[model samples]
Target: MQKVVIVEDFCIACYNCEVACVATHSRSEEPIKAYKRENLRGRSNALVEVNGPIAFSAMCRHCKHPWCLDTCISGAIQRLDNGIVYLDEERCVGCWGCVLGCPYGVAHPNLKGEEKHAFKCDLCIDRLEAGLKPACVEACPNKALIYDETMEETEGAYNR
Candidate 1:
């Protein structure tokens, strides 16, 4: 299944996407409180930036040849048939290969900022299972991010 990709060309680099992401994933469903919680408790699911007008919005690629899976000597990362990659936290040795191997720089050493195990977007497998869009994509105001299992159009190729 083809997936949502960003069109940075259209991005205004407003922190809207970032803010939206926090709201989407937060326990309180409010942004400011979410920030305080994430910083104070140091729990996080992902990161966002827009200063480059080139903010990176990313998730696991669930690759046909997944570097995270291959690099994990601990055998913690697993690729599922549904095009989602996940981690077995118990088996993770915190070796950080997945972080280093991730071409997008999305995976990181401490997702919760508490545990040392690396983590990245699991594409919100729960949401996908519910037939719901990823929270980040659903919450983005600029419509900068999108989620689609079926890519019906290649319209962007001609736009640039």
Candidate 2:
């Protein structure tokens, strides 16, 4: 499964990934327009955390055995063969079950309108289908986020 990995030493805590993530997920699909539109609220699935001089981004790990999938009573959460865990908003009941079930605390409630639903990173499946990296990974100016690499390659990267 392709996953985003943090190169913590390279992170500058710029929060660019968060901004890019929100823009990509926004209804307007533009950072400036999304910010200006009150009804077009967007939230970053990836959250930046700073501890002393260290900073890292946190998001869904898309676990092999996702707790959110198992705990979802409405069956809105499904794990694809490629290991992407997706939430079907139309089938969601806004029960916050996934929110509580997610070990990484990545799952959140959609608060845009009267009707609520669960939200989280879908690994930018649409972008991946278009042969593009996830917005967060692509926006990292410091190259802190790396994705779609073999285990040996990842180990070699850090070894350097």
Candidate 3:
């Protein structure tokens, strides 16, 4: 399965990945529209962590056996054949089960609209289907994030 690998040493704490993620998932697919007009400035799936001199970007790992999928009471979380853990917003009941179950704390609750739901990185399934890399990976100017298809899935591989 494909994964977004983090080159922690190369990260510069830039938030371009977060911006690209919000814009890509926005209705207008534009940074300005997504942030200003759509009020989605901080609703990015990709999160950038900065600790003094060290920094890195993180998102859903799409684990082989996702706890989010198992804990979803509404059956909104589904693991596709490609190993991507997807959350169907329409089916989500705002239960927050997936949020509490996610080991990485990447699953987020979407309370912006009238109906609440959950959201997370889908690895940009639409972009992948269109033969393109995820917005976060493509927008990293320092090449800190890598879309790696050859990554081996081992237990606690993300502990690094």
Candidate 4:
């Protein structure tokens, strides 16, 4: 399964994750160009918390038994065996059930307020297919976010 473990002991609240998320998800989809603007918030992503030693940064957990997939009567949300979850916008009914069902509150609707539909992290599946890390993981100067599929990479998450 695709996942990221963030090491809070080393995080500096630099917001590299937030910016990288926007760049990877933006309509332009270019990190260099995206950084030229003042609107880091322009993309469909968010930063979680900023304080506490060992404080965790969160995104889609892709639960073993997903409440989002269960509550979504429209069948918009589904999980793959590898444990990455995604919402099919075409099949979605603009129902907020998935958003409500998500324990982590990762699935968001109308991210920028202009968009009526919702979206969330799919573990940056596109980048993963290209043999690259998620943008947030690559952008972190502290290397707090480690994108890996092995059991060892997930040790930090379990400890938390």
Please list the Cα RMSD from the true structure of every candidate, rounded to 1 decimal place: 3.6, 2.7, 2.0, 3.2
For model 4, residues 1-160, the per-residue Cα lDDT tens digits are 4677666667777777877898887667776666565343644444556655544456777677888898888877888777888887778777788889888877877654544666777788889889898888888888677776874533234453
Worst 10 residues of 1 by lDDT: 40-49
Clashes of 1: 0
- Model 3: lDDT equals 0.88
Candidate 2 Cα misplacement greater than 4 A, ranges? 38-42, 149-160
**Candidate 2 local Cα displacement, residue 109, angstroms:** 1.7
**Can you give the lDDT of residue 152 in candidate 1?**
49
Pairs in steric clash, model 2: none
Model 4: CA > 4 A from native: 31-42, 52-55, 152-156
RMSD of model 1 against the true structure: 3.6
**Residue range 1-160, candidate 1, lDDT tens digits:** 5355565555555556556555655678688888886552333344555564466555555666787787898888998887678877678889999888888666667655556787666666667778888776776667666667775446443143
Q: In what order do the candidates fall by TM-score, top score first?
A: 3, 2, 4, 1
Clashing pairs in 1: none
Task: Give the alpha carbon lDDT tens digit for every residue of 1-160 in model 2.
Answer: 4778778888899988888888888887787776677344457788898999988888888777899998899989999887899988889999998999898889988887677988888999899989999999999999898776464323333532
User: Looking at candidate 1, what is the lDDT of residue 94?
Assistant: 90
Best by TM-score: 3
Which residues of candidate 3, in runs, are more than 4 Å off?
154-160
